[model samples]
Target: MTDYAIGDLQGCHAEFVELLERIDFAPARDRLWLAGDLVNRGPDSLACLREVRALGNAAFTILGNHDLHLLAVARGGARLNRKDTLDDILAAPDREALLDWLQSRPLLVRQAFDAGGDTVMVHAGLLPQWSADEAAGLAGEVEARLGSERSGAFLEQMYGNEPACWQASLDGIDRLRVIVNVLTRMRFIDADGCLDFSAKEGLDSAPAGFAPWFRYPRRDDLRLVFGHWAALQGRAEGARVRAEATDTGCVWGGNLTALNLDTGERIGVSSHLRR
Candidate 1:
């Protein structure tokens, strides 16, 4: 019963399947932890959805920025960008079922055992200020509503650029979007953990306003795994907390990576140039 956490799929269904086969994954025993962005901006977005959804309990997927964008567009609250690969999904007959399944997935995933300590997974990252307990509580609120009929209303409030800071008192869509961005889209943030969404450049060129979220002092208390920054290309340096950047830029012609949770071993399959 090996457990693996994979990098972003980004609609690369073929690679995803190949990686599983390479590892000889058994759905009944092995578990797959997805780092998020399971769809969009690549071929086979629909196929990815169908395949992962079929995995059922064997696959635990968190929501990525692209995944959330799909929900927003489906709810008519957001526009589909030019690079989006979600058209096939939005136009598919199983769109409703797919979206429902996606929304039902959590923003944070935790695994615990009697021997080993707890490990938590989030799509992107947790704020430096948040404890694991706080992250769990906040993510649960959104997940419950996302899996409910009120999900449409939640999607409506899911889009925006304001309230870039976290406040415990925040309610409604403003609060939800902030949490989603931090958990899914975050990469670099300021000392105050204010998100720096504008700078997508390489690490050395990060703008003056931001620092990597894991760099925040208090983050060392938690054992966490995250993705969402292809720019990092899977470079993580820390002591107590393991910041694993699994997105190898497969959508931009890189490999897809998977990590063995129990052994901390990493395996990757090439994107084969995506020609």
Candidate 2:
């Protein structure tokens, strides 16, 4: 019963299936931890969502920025961008079910290892100030709001880059926004420990005084698994914590990647999309 953590699907259904086949995944025996972005950007958003949702209890998924964007757009909180490929999902017959399932996902997931330590999964990265347990607790706050009747209103105010840093005193929408950004949209952090949303290219494209979030020292023994920065191409080393990057940019004509949490093995399937 191995647990595999997969990178962002981004609607690449064929590659996703191929990767599962390559790994010989059996839902009855093995469990999957998905790093989110289950839909959008690639050719088959609808199919991807269906496939994951059908996995049921065998799969655990955290909410990515793209996933949240889909929910927001569906609820009239945001508009689709030119590059988005989420129309199929929006127009699907089970759109409501899919969106509800997605909205209920948490921003952080943690699993403890029998050998000690833990594996923490998030769509992007965690704020330097947050420990694994603290992040999970904060994520629950957003999950509650998203799963409630006022979710549409929360989604409407979910966008933005303000309150760029974490503060215990933060409340209301501002606090929720910070938690969401750190767990979903985060890539780099400035010297002051604030999130830098401007850079998305790669490590070298980090804004002045900013570096990848994992570079900061974390006083925990947990391993971190995350997707979202495809530019890393599934590698980010020299971090204080044991961080595994899983997004191999399958939507950008790269490979779909999965990491075996128990064995420290990585398997990848090349994307069919032309570069």
**TM-score, each model?**
0.93, 0.97
Give the alpha carbon lDDT tens digit for every residue of 1-275 in model 1: 88888988989999998999999999999999998899998898999999999999999899988898898889746888888989999999999899888878899988874433578899888897888888998999888778774546777777666888888888888888788888888877887778877877567656787777877777444567887878778776542255666788888788888988888788889895564
The reply for model 2, stretches above 4 Å from the true place, is none
Among all candidates shown, the one with the greatest lDDT? 2
Return the lDDT, model 1, position 199. Answer: 77
- Residue pairs of candidate 2 with colliding backbone atoms: none
Per-residue lDDT of candidate 2, residues 1-275 (tens digit): 88999999999999999999999999999999999899888999899989999999999998999999998899946899999999998888888898888878878888886643588899998877788778989999999888784547888788799989878989999999999998899999976669888899988898888889989888877788999999999998668778889999999999998888888799999999996
